[model samples]
Target: MRTSFIKKKKNASTDVALQITSMADIFMILLVFLLKNYATSVTNIAPTAHLSLPEVNKSKGVIKETLKVEIANDLVMIDQKPALALHAFQFDPSEDGPGGVSPTVARVLNEQRKLRPEPNMDSSLLVMADQQTPYSTIKRVVASAASAGFVDLQLVVVQGE
Candidate 1:
């Protein structure tokens, strides 16, 4: 008996490609969500030195229509306006017992608080100070605001880049 050899044939075909439309749709949804959550009225304060703020576990969101106090190296601003010039403070060691916040800061805060619709309501005051700023300076500013009847104080910090 004679045996014969046979050759096998291969199928020429390609697998189905994956569709990326679903992924694009998901990304679009995520973009919309992030855009909706973006803050519109953010108060930006440029500090003279990098400051690492003491953190708290609690989360405090922004309060609408609040006062802002910016403390720079040699000047202080209220609501982004120059309320007190550099020479406004008495740097003389003999005259001024200790460095103090400008009286105008307290007065302005008081006036703004009065103008607020809900004076009795709990309103927040945001304080932005440079990192190199001495603790005494921070305390003085906070004390002035407190004396002006600002109970809720929020120290502003950069959350992330």
Candidate 2:
């Protein structure tokens, strides 16, 4: 009788060896549900302290799929990295002894272009400028981007709160 009881216990333990297929099924269902509800078409790029975009009423939504250059009052940033510092809204590129286009900006733009497949300077650029930024300063940044071959520039602005 004892031997029969031991045999029954062993059989029960074997039957209880964790049912993993059910757990796997649950995970698969959850993954499918999440994928179906995921939002993939829109890309959102938020502004930072160094780049405070002006508020505009009739502008389109933000485009974050392309390369970005941010021009601040005292700094220029590309890809969120500080590419150069300005002295009173002026930067002398170390590459070209003082007084041409901001060399640092030009060089960084060229480098950024290399990441694209097109050999020509045809990368789309987004310029995020502050409200207090001067028009002349904005022109210099646009010119530098154009020289680097990025003609498709979309100015970044915020919606009125």
| TM agreement with the true structure for every prediction | 0.55, 0.63
Structure candidate 2, residue pairs in collision = 121-149
Q: Can you write out model 2's per-residue Cα lDDT over 1-161, one digit (the tens) per residue?
A: 44654444434444557899999999999998877766553334555446567888877775756777887877888877788877656655453433435666888989988977674645688788778888777778877777788888888777675
lDDT of 1: 0.64
Cα deviation at 149, candidate 1, in Å, is 0.3
- Give RMSD to native, each candidate: 8.0, 7.4
Model 2, poorest ten-residue lDDT window?
5-14
TM-score of 2: 0.63
* Lowest lDDT 10-residue stretch of candidate 1: 88-97
- Regions more than 4 Å wrong, model 1: 1-65, 87-101
lDDT of 1 by residue, 1-161 (tens): 65646655667667878899999999999998877766553425444333344444554655445677777666777776666543322222322223364466677778877877787774678787765577766676776687678878877765543
Distance from true position, residue 142, model 2, in Å?
A: 1.0
Which prediction has the highest lDDT against the true structure?
A: 2
